[model samples]
Target: MLPPLKALPVFEAVARLNSFSRAATELNVSQSAISHQIRVLEDYLGESLFQRQGRYLALTQEGKNYLDVVSSSLSHIARASNQIRGEEDTKIRIAVYSSFAVCWLMPRLSDLQHKHPNLDITITMTHGSPELSDKTADCFITTDTEKRGFEYQLLYKETLFPVCSHAFYEQIKNTLNVTSDELSKRLKDEPELLENFPLITSNGIYNEYTEDWRSWFLERGIPLSNNIKFHKFSHLILAYEAAKYSLGIALVNDYMFSDKDTHSALVRLPSHRIYTNDHFFFSYKTSRRNETAIKALKQWILNEASSLNTLA
Candidate 1:
């Protein structure tokens, strides 16, 4: 007995083009192979599926009925196969700004892992404008307000302040107690302190979108100086650690500090609260919304964000 499945490719191609030679060319097989498959299919069905006229082939009544079923089934199989392959190989790359990665997301990553042990997450530290459409990241976690066609989930509204290590603070306590102005002057003049301390500057390159050390100091009514010496590390976490090790006082987001790490030390400097309300969102390609992985991601992010009271 001949199998219907074995002849489906030949049948489908011939049905589509209405010619045996054309079907053979499309399937990348010899014309004789196409003829043999069709003959086998016809014998199995006990009916002539196509009517030959000159060199052309036309579907008979039986052929038309079979073509409808076979074509629909083949299309469905193709779609299913593609979906399965996409799910296995697909990566959900998320681009996040430095400070947020260190202070907000990194601490909470365990929660995501507990919920989705098998899901793959690719995190890249990108400064300002993750460029979602350009395929830089599947999702962007940014402070930007104008994100279109993305499923925006507000992770947290950040509050920024000064933080330094306990050991670093102890070394400067007598000096800091003199007066706020005197301490500020000392910090500005001390080149070694600045060099050792990760100043916790947000942007590697200055962009209008990024929050800067000068902006934060200006907001606090402190004047900017040319003599202030500090090393610039591109990402927020590196800066955070530099401060944690007593390198220098870093004006950083409050969100990056973890209460649980015994070795991790951070103390907020005496400054007024610096608050910024920005939302982070998960965005997928619009065409990919229906895919299983995309759907899974959307639901997972929504659920996690909701519990944290960060979802918008």
Candidate 2:
């Protein structure tokens, strides 16, 4: 029969520390208690595990061999127990793209919590693609449609639109008197609207296919300017906040505007619309697809997507 795990920990601690009193100090137990536990453990094993030296205890040959196996087994048990407890406690680790987290997921997260009250979801931000090999997170929220090594479900697709704050409109609503092309050019020249205002950018998220202010203006048949100043952001939501506060106009994707209140504060600029293939997707390691918690979340996300599509 295997030895009790409780005894093995005390024995391992005493063996590593090489002094029962020191081990007791570390474990917050009396030296006599530590010595008694070790004695019980050695008796149970039917071996003298320690040899008396000048003023200390040394591991016997049997003790050395047993220590090698027992130490490893005990450490493994501790880690596994912690993991099981975490799962039982309904703790979940999730990795989300910063842009999606701020603009879309965060506002809707309470819905998930309300349904799964026991679930504790902790999120970490990924700059672009998350490292799948790390397993730091059990799930990831991404925009890529490509098939990964994990089970995946599409959350939502997004389209692009021009949005500006109420303050921005109040300042440039007079420019609306000109032709759409002329208005874009004139508005592009406003220091508050164009020069001083920060343009939220997706530097890493869409570096290969960056959405540029000049492209947005040129789409309206206006000449791209050389004097215009622009700024970029790693996450799109940061840009949304800047735009919401009248920092400047942002070519926000539709999914980012999750709130009716935020939507009402901004007006879509004239003749401005763009299409992109970006969409939110949830993914998990393929081996974990059958896990109870993963299956639960998967079903909920799919049901939500289906309902959203039906409404659309």
Candidate 3:
């Protein structure tokens, strides 16, 4: 009860491009071949799909509906096939936040590779949360949030603090004519001194626990003033970078600055830290928990997390 699967691809290409000639070129087929395939599909369906207007073509109402279904189905099939192929080759696909990918995960990736040279890992950076039902990635590293039907392991709980470049810290120290210890004590006692400098924070409304400047100040019972200068960035990584370049002081998490390289660039303010309820978690489908590659990755990630916990 199916039309030719071969013709379906040709029909979809023509419907998407709105031109048989262009679809033929894209598919590396002759225009006549494309026309024949479309005609065959239309005959099988017993309905015209496209409305012809001189040299141009447009989808009919029925064509639009069919195209939607066909496109989604084709894409799902392709993804499923690729996932199976990847699994056979011992590949692990990880979906993680863009900021974590750049700041935390990428820096530590060489360790993973050194430990498991045969394991092929693919990283997909996303701004939004991962969809576990989609089976898009074998694993996802994300902030703690309520979800059901997936196996998850805690990576680390993050602590927030105000951070700036060493140059900026020296500038503040010199301006106050205080030693490093004195500067720390003074900043702790007079937290309001932070308002004198340019502040950097995320423009995204992630969550209350995201540790933006407003939340950081509110946690300390010091109300942030509306008149204070701020440089808002679309992503946390950008804010972190701006702070590193001494553009402004940024509210950042402990994990992002954990590495010696990052810590060398930035210094956390003394005695001003906020602990977040949200923790980083490594999640995977329950069905895949026992798969060899998944199991290996899970163990490795847990070991890394345990080491971080010990250090913390």
Candidate 4:
């Protein structure tokens, strides 16, 4: 027997988005209307589809299995409708870190536009890793490797290093009396040099507390000073900006420091790079993996990440 066709859209939207209010907004209906349709669908299926815990909504195991079928079938139906109506543009929404969007993806976005004029993109910048749900975005630039019912493409491995403003670099480059490569070696070998400047830190790196500097120092066999001065910021971007203004040397990574931005203002101290278990992956729901918008963006982003990873 066929499920209630009309109720399926309501269930899919509520399930994918994980919010009755948001599903109502997307469906242009009332929240009560969403709940009613969900009840109807669950009753027809003779099983519970959603588990409610206070203000949050989550899918049951059966609900998750059913959604894979429903979302894919609905997408194909919508694709057929778009084709019949001669639709030209497809919008792809992405969730990414604020720093990566500014430093890497922003400048190169136009190139993606040039390559695929029929594709529209919307970006939702995030401070930390967001949960994998349609409400987060249709696509995610995330470090999460869990693949329950999602597809992933490896973007780049996490690479850690420190940077200071070119202004700050000039002040110490001659004092150190060493080539850039040799300076990097010194930064790794000479822990005492840190006494000359303060360390800028961020809690946003790898969702850990001040591990950015700690990892770089420990990874390079340099010990953190007991009495070193430190400055902290809420986000990695803030720390990067502070470094650009010569506030101090901020521990950063290649993902945060890209060649495409106005990065000439910053100097890379490549003495040591801490590579962690973290690696960025471009992820999307497996059911929608074949969508034109998702396919195009995945290929272009993979190419871009490949170029940089190859260079490094």
> What is candidate 4's local distance difference test score?
0.81
**Every candidate's lDDT:** 0.65, 0.66, 0.78, 0.81
Ten residues in a row with the worst lDDT in model 3? 203-212
Q: Cα-based RMSD of the predictions, in order?
A: 13.6, 10.2, 5.7, 4.2
How much is 186 displaced in model 3, in angstroms? Answer: 1.6
lDDT per residue for candidate 3 within 1-312, as digits (tens), equals 977899888887898788899999999999999989888888999889999989968988988878866865675566467678884446778998888788778877899899988888898988877765433577898774566757889988776678899899888788788999998888888888888888887854344322377777887798887778888788788889999999978887756776345436898777577666667889986756766667888888788667554434
Which candidate number has the best lDDT? 4
How many backbone overlaps does candidate 2 show?
A: 1
* lDDT at 109, model 1: 84
The candidate, 1 or 3, that scores higher on TM-score is 3
Using Cα atoms with residue i matched to residue i, what is each candidate's TM-score against the true structure? Answer: 0.52, 0.58, 0.70, 0.78
lDDT of 1 at 192: 32
Spell out the clash pairs found in candidate 2: 201-233
Candidate ranking (TM-score, best to worst): 4, 3, 2, 1
User: Candidate 1, which segments miss by more than 4 Å at Cα?
Assistant: 1-91, 98-107, 124-128, 134-137, 144-148, 177-202, 205-211, 225-231, 258-263, 276-279, 286-292, 295-312
- Estimate, for each residue in 229-293, the C-alpha lDDT of model 2 and write its tens digit: 55566556767777778877777765565334544667655444544556677888675565555
Worst 10 residues of 1 by lDDT: 189-198
Question: Which candidate model has the greater lDDT, 2 or 3?
Answer: 3
Q: Name the runs in model 4 displaced over 4 angstroms.
A: 10-39, 42-73, 83-89, 174-185, 188-192, 206-208, 259-263
Q: What lDDT tens digits, residue by residue, belong to model 4 across residues 1-312?
A: 898898999998998889999999999999999989998999999999999999978999999988877976786688778867888338878999888899789878889989998888999888778677764578899988685888889898877677889878876777777777777788767755865678898887656656777776776566777777888888878898999899988877776676555637787865656677778899998877877788899999998888656535
